[model samples]
Target: MIIRENSMLSRRHLLSLLAAGTAMGGAAGLTTGVAHAQAAIPDITLGDPSAPVTVVEYASYTCPHCAEFHSDTFKDFKAEYIDTGKVHFIYREVFFDRYGLWAAMIARCAGPENYFGIADLIYAGQGDWARQGDPAAVADSLKRIGLQAGLSQGQVDACLQDAAMAEGLYGWYQENATRDGVRSTPSFLINGDMHSGNMNLSQIGQLVDEASS
Candidate 1:
């Protein structure tokens, strides 16, 4: 769970993984009052930045538990908290494998403005895209996802080939995940306290109310 400095996420390891991932095709949450700025983390954020409560989510694109949270709980939470500007959400990626990294690249392909929307597509289609179990098939499916999300093939390819960006993201995830003691997907730092596993909207709403109050 603790991926230290010597872990496979080192730039060299990631590059090698990328090469292997290419043969495979691929693949593949938060809130609160304004979360304090962390310039070092490369996160895609949502809601009002100046909102009173900041909620941070750590998740992987290929994680089933994460998908369930997105499918069952996130809609209500987003409606009640994020849209109303009661919480600011920051999404941090956790790379459990190369497939996850590939998924992340696809989400980032459309750029931050469309990142969450693309992510929703990824999670919603997880059953079809990830169950194929062929790296090449998975990769193709992810590109289709990118296309569905309004990305050109060129944009998707560019995002996938950005080795430097991928390496930087590896380090970014490593540092933040370790610092926050994140050992699993669907983990959250609700106002800076780590909460792991799935949580209902009501549970999350109460936490947000408490943090913002």
Candidate 2:
């Protein structure tokens, strides 16, 4: 519960992290080996566990820049670094608002198998969903995304209405933000070092290579 100022889910501070940047990588053909990540934690990571470089991302679902990074940068990173087992990438959710929280629940509802796909949809449709500014509508839209991923409305609703899960997620965020000095969205923890702001493909590639070397 060590949120901003040692408070949990400090909404104001968390928004700054989302605004911080719009912001990962592959698994050396071993995605399944590590696919069963720490389900107890609110993290969904992909890549070879023994990758030389570990990249942790702190992002908010509502952040447009986050959407852009996922849309523009992630694919390449995933292909070269992650898929090749050059880096391990972890995605930790940072909730800036209730819309984001609801979205997080929906993504989790889809389960690990469909998490990334659902996340892609959320980021790609950020404008359409967040613009509504109505929690109920946004929640419904998120549920649709889940349904398309083959989830049931009841399942989605269960995750959404489960206030305990939301708190747990927020707690996870607080721990990440505090431990990693995450000042913005898309902040990265590269091998335990904090690097804020979104990085381009080449820049990230070089960093990973350097770390590997």
Candidate 3:
């Protein structure tokens, strides 16, 4: 597997800058920190105990394109592939900032059963949460969202502060992204082949067909 060096600035440095009120505001600071923590982990998979095809996605919650893909194309894909046991879908987090990572952790903390539900909400609400402009406020909003999804405030807070878990996530993303030649958000790996950008259902279906064959 090939690995590529991350070109984005480190999450810690971005958070420090935000805290200092240099590049970003308080909201941005919180988002950056949380997103960094999320980045320090790897992708999580769901669907199909014994599928022939595996589809992995490297995505960021803050990415508009990723959100669009989720909104427009994912339902069909899930219905056809994920739900029917033809494909095992893995969702990996890639952070563009702290907010993105924080969102990822919140989704993960919901546990595997609820991970996709929370992820859908995050992607759907990405515009509102990411642009809220107050780190504490954004965190609180996310906390509330998590609570609605059955996560306690304590659970969300604990997950957010999990440095070791965050590091593991980052390491996993780093390695996977490298191996899959992913340089941008919404990149995909279909049975070890790489495809980038937001793809239509037909395009993905074709890839799935190829993989299965």
**Which one is best on TM-score?**
1
* Tens-digit lDDT track of model 3 for 131-201: 88877677777777788888887787766665555555655655766667678878888888888888889
Give TM-scores for every candidate, taking all chains together and pairing residue i with residue i.
0.84, 0.80, 0.80
Q: Each candidate: what lDDT?
A: 0.77, 0.70, 0.73
Q: Check candidate 2 and list the clashing pairs.
A: 17-184, 17-185, 22-65, 23-69, 25-82, 26-82, 26-83, 27-82
Candidate 2 per-residue lDDT over residues 18-118, each given as its tens digit: 22321101112112212122225546999988988999888888777688789999999999889998899999998656677778878888677778988
RMSD of 1: 7.6
At residue 156, give the lDDT of candidate 2: 70
